[model samples]
Target: MRPIPHPGRPGKLLRLLAEKYPTKEAVMSRLIYLQGQLVLPKGVEHFMSDLHGEYAAFYHILNNCSGVIREKVDYVFGARMSKEEKAEFCTLIYYPKEKIEQMTAARRATPAWYRENIARCLALARLMSWKYPASRLPGLIPARLRPVLVELLATRPEADAAQLAYQQRLLASIVQADAGAEFLEDFASLVKRLAVAEFHFVGDFFDRGGRPDAILDRVMALPEVDIEWGNHDVLWMGAALGSPACIATVVRNSLRYDNVDVLERGYGISLRPLVTFAQHLYPDEAPIRAAERAATILLFKVEGALIERNPDLGMANRRLLHCIDFRNVCAVLPSGRYELRKAYFPTIDEDAVDPYVLTLEEREILDGLVTSFTESPSLRRHVDFLYRKGSLYLVRNGNLLFHGCVPLTEDGAFCEITYDGKKYAGRAWLDFCDQMARAAYLYHEQEALDFMYFLWCGRLSPLSGREVRTFERTFLADKTTWEEPADPYYRLLDDEETCERVLKEFGLSPKKGHIINGHVPVKVKKGESPVKAGGRAIIIDGGFCKAYHEKTGISGFTLISNSRGLRLLAHQKIADVRTALADNGDIESVSETVELATIHTTVGDTDKGRAMQEEITDLYNLLLAYQNGVLKPQA
Candidate 1:
């Protein structure tokens, strides 16, 4: 892999920048351009969470910028463009390829329409690009269209008619060459890229919805984004790393939701081994009604082994297979003896001692499944992207982003865990777990890989937070056994002191920093507020997964933080993306002001801004070194 050049490259910074900006004019011009960008408004930061494989909705939010684009369009065009025209423009910008094809098919290519819309897109791009540094604008534009875009943006509205005519003629030539549609498509993408400075995924990108792969495609291409790994995301990531426990969970959950298409089609993973194993083990048993009991029994044994291995994980009593009196067709539970919902388990192997162990055929199938998980190129690529750009939690620009809780004890204190003979809690514990997660993929040792299993469901895991009752939920006839306790962190959310302590532990100012997180949905339908800890913390996950839309009663929540203030936007439920687009209906969003700064925030307030300021200081030092004759000044 080659190392890519970024804004700040340490040690040889003077030499590196000297290559491109050898002339003093070039260096000084860039410094001036950057200095100018600093005073201008900060680019907006968009925060989204729990997309959960709803590709179309995710695409809508990314394309429309949660109605930010619409507002900008209204501001830019207003009464100059009619309502109908504004709809068409927004649709084209969001779905350029499809909209262009529709236009070309419906009406023959008209130079006037092409010319006008291209100008509209360029205008929006111009608005988005203003706050960006002038030096970086060229790189953001496509090579073939760069000069025209530059001309369009750089031309003053007060320019002479002759100069304006030249710009018009250039566009006419583009349309005459039949490249208008493709050009606008590229330009539209460029507009979307520049519209938001950074994209943040608060977590849970897989399961419950279709097409996580599509979402990953956009995520991978984004110029800047960060992810906080959600529990479900870790489940899939663990499977991709060949953890058998995770593999079982993924397969079972996918099957439970009838989402096998995600596995067989989206990821191209063959489930033949499992299919054959099921056949071989069950031997064509008649009536799935009777066979489901046997299937459930086998599943219990598998889940039981996982729970029994980690007894102190708070699920030791989840092992219920041994308590089953096969002869009597019942299982004993803490609540009392319960009658089996479905009996007749032919594959129980009652006389055998270790019922928790997988059969020979079952082992072979599991090995094959593990192979498929680890060997699938597509699955590995997406998980690799997650590993590259994600973490358990991130503290950025005075806000803390995490998918799950910090793992608190019953009494509302940090749950300490000993690793390498050292007790770790709070931020240090999270850092240690992150390292262990990475090592789980890099190293082949059983201990390393097994740690992925622990992090996925262990009671003390910040990612898992509570004991997972997989065995109890699948096998128990008692509904009481199905209850998995919520993490204490969930209940302590309104504690300002707790939230402040968390912020301080992460090295953020307790007063200024905020915890912006989501794992559990904010049940707005039930009157649960997302803002907690007396406004020190916020949960933005509002169930982007269609499966939860009914329960959550809203599409999801997004945060937009720009120069002026921080605002929270809530989206209404989406029926269908194609239908919504065809009707020219945007995801109707309502926003509430979370904070309005007395003074607009600037780039200097951001983490990247600090990095840039350091670079500016370094450049000044380089200038000094050149004057002192330690390094020669470039021409």
Candidate 2:
């Protein structure tokens, strides 16, 4: 009757209303009112808890609320909430206590991979500590004594009375064997005097020759020494850390040394020392510790500045050094012995030559030169003949030297000339030449063509029969100019200016000291013929790497200086070191075979052993084409 006082009233009203109007609409309206009452109270509770309680209570309340209400409420709450409040809410809802705790514990536990890495690092550190104690005391001992110290420590660890006597004898032998003047004796005296200070090898104390681990042991003995990153060192560290790229680099470097077994065995053994060290030193934070250990190992492999002085040696040893520094597992233990002196090389500023211009043919010719001279036992005796009779000259000073011509006058100093009949000079020529050199080392086919063009033309030119003739003419003309110039030599002027500029840029002064460089071969048949026409630059190349007088050996001149006037040390050669070392199980036959195969393929030749000689011709042609941009890839 009175609308039953609405369906949602008291129980009596509801019964009366149902009797009067039991329609679906009336029932729905009553249900809605009941739902509103339930939700309204719950919503108020959620809001109250979220505002007053910390994040934990807020989240609990949110969870208990109905999904629909919670979503709407969240949006409203977010609008009025402070940043800190919002963050707290997020933390509570997204990260429960249990989950947070689990994550914290998991992070604390070092991963298996990381633990292994730390072990490797510690091994390297130990090696340095044991071998090069002088390294720990920086600025106390001169750089020259540090290497000697490493060698002594490596050979003798116990410091027994007998061992000390043996070390003295050994030092004498080393001094006698060394072609260097009394420098070794001076260095030894210095070491004894400066024994109080720790010596450190900042970089590259090991790798490349043989007995890498042994060398490492010697370096690692140093207590005060630390290491920095070198390109080669980085590679080894990366490889030890299980970096794929580093592994690939290791594999590549192994090819150069022809020591696949050594690579594998050394890598394994090197890792052993590191693992032991990490476990011993950093038992808790193994992974991070392992990384540091690996890094330390790499630091010992840093190549010294001596490498920069000997470009040929640097090229030949790059892969080996890289492997040792980056991928090889050579570990060293330090032994306190003799101190080592650091060797310094004077930097020269020459045009940056293009490596691509160096082609396989050019490299082959250079290698042939080195091989012929070095291989011949008699060549060492006749080195003077090669210089005086063979149109070679030996010129050098204490600090910096070069084999090419120096500028005759300042006017022609920065002038650019075509190197391979190409229409570029200065930086372009240098870049092109460097590129060629790189290609040759990599055994690229086009390296030959580039080489020929560079030799025949003053610059790179298009590859064609007609162009070849033109290039030859230009080359001949240039050569004639070089030979017949009476007043001023162009090349010498360019070289001197370039060198001056480089020294200035590096904050070095030419007047600081002497500089020695060798590239152009000396004339053995001519006596004391001037290598450079008018520049201050000196030439000491002396055809050391080339065949002279049918001799097979590698020859090199030494520069020795003190208070006395600068003098050129006689040229010396070592015969078949590569073959001897490689054959004595230092390098695997299979590795050599693989390298040869790789070289053949890269040079676009399908040949083995005997047929290898024919590839040289093709390499020459390809180099020329590349220089002229006739090669499609321009490589």
Candidate 3:
């Protein structure tokens, strides 16, 4: 048989064929087709003569075939498939020179089958050359599969991309694989490795969101996590107690759906378990028990869904859910009945003042304060030295780190007295300061009662410059009355005096050169401003649990001290405080300027008049829109 002519070039087609089909079977098939030894099987015409296959074989395969075959085949016969028996016999054996000469002359008359077969082989080789592992598939694969492959590879111990993809496809084909379980196990392992200093959960831990029991279970399972009591926790606990009012008022208000019986039953069943958990966690603290009781009551008042949405209510609820103390019980008079009453310091009997109850730290601080007073002559001098100028200053490194601020006397100074040759001044001069501090402490203990009073009435004013003098006169002359009536503005003073006294009593000063006080939330700015007094009094309590500002975020601070200097740190972002308020159904009527002014005057001096004015203006606009039906009331 005449040698086939190369389709394009001998070297190029051979190289193309070698690159396209490295495997023996693929190479042998292409070679046999090029030699014109392959025949289309009967009844497979559709598969064999498809346009795509024809295009691949003619344009791609023959065009890329060896040049020697092209030359020989073209010399013997033109490019065409053979239909005669002679052509089939020619494909089986080599032809002599006489036959080759004759075939070459005949090729000029009729095209040879081997030429077409070589072209088809070259086309097939070209198509196969472009095929990638992914492209070999008939249909388009999803884009997500690549990432899935990568992720699987990352998770496997020794699997690479190829192995991962293979295994993934194999696994996907299997029925009912435990993908979710595997993912959860991996996530749990990751969580175990992460170390967290503290976990501050912001409400919604129970009853509102689904699976409160599950959440509580997870929290209890983790031994190190300490939760700051939230309103929902309190409501659930209260509901368990079977207190109708607590359930109806607090718990009911927080429920998403109106299911009185279900809520009651849920609380009834949940209460014992919750209380048992609390007892296990905090056995020594009675506040936990009180909080549980309070929570049940709150649940009756508020619904879980509403409470979940309002974080402020949750926070306030948590803060107020303290254990029932005897002093709190005494303040209300009747121990069993819950009544709204103004907080006042209970009259402490001499027998109640147990010296043993005082911590060593407290005794030391008290001794220092007394000693400093005994050494100082002038009351003003003593106050300044104790708070501002003493060797152990009351304001530690300008932190204003007193237990509390002194109730300013009428003379614009703290109360002063000379007792046992010791100059006892400031809050220490009057027994009332102690009473006020105790009241504040009680308020801190039972936030709901305190807040209820604040809502209906108003916050007790801190001692002012005038009241300190009145208190001083009363203590000195042993009379409650003064020539000029004590200014009511003095009431706005926070328990700063008491805080100072306590700090002094406890021997806890600003040794590290800054102070963080919790008794009063003093608004401090680095520079003097019309809105705030300039000082180092960093108020951590921005009334987070009690009051909140829509414009500001959660009011908390972290004080980091170093040799470089002290830095006042605030949260990078503010939280939505309004949502919290609305959730608890504690929304209050917007007070007008006049009303705010009245409130301000009652609290302290009228220093906040301008601020109150702006607030009143906003309130007015809000109310006007509400009246005009522009804004709907938020649930």
All candidates' lDDT scores?
0.77, 0.29, 0.29
Quote the positional error of residue 216 for candidate 2 in Å.
22
Rank by TM-score, highest first.
1, 2, 3
The TM-scores, one per candidate, come to: 0.91, 0.24, 0.23
Model 1 clashing residue pairs (backbone): none
Residue 394, candidate 1: how far off, in angstroms? 0.8
The superposed Cα distance between candidate 3 and the true structure at residue 10, in angstroms, equals 99
Off by over 4 Å in 1: 1-34, 279-317, 344-346, 419-421, 575-577, 632-635
Between candidates 1 and 2, name the one with more favorable TM-score.
1
Error of 2 at 451 (Å): 8.6
What is the Å distance of residue 504 in model 3 from its true position?
5.3
Tell me how far the alpha carbon of residue 366 in candidate 3 is from the true structure, in angstroms, after superposition.
49
What ranges in model 2 sit over 4 Å off? Answer: 1-133, 136-411, 417-508, 513-515, 529-535, 549-556, 560-567, 572-635
lDDT of the structure predicted as candidate 3: 0.29
TM-score of 2: 0.24
lDDT minimum window of 10 residues, candidate 2: 41-50
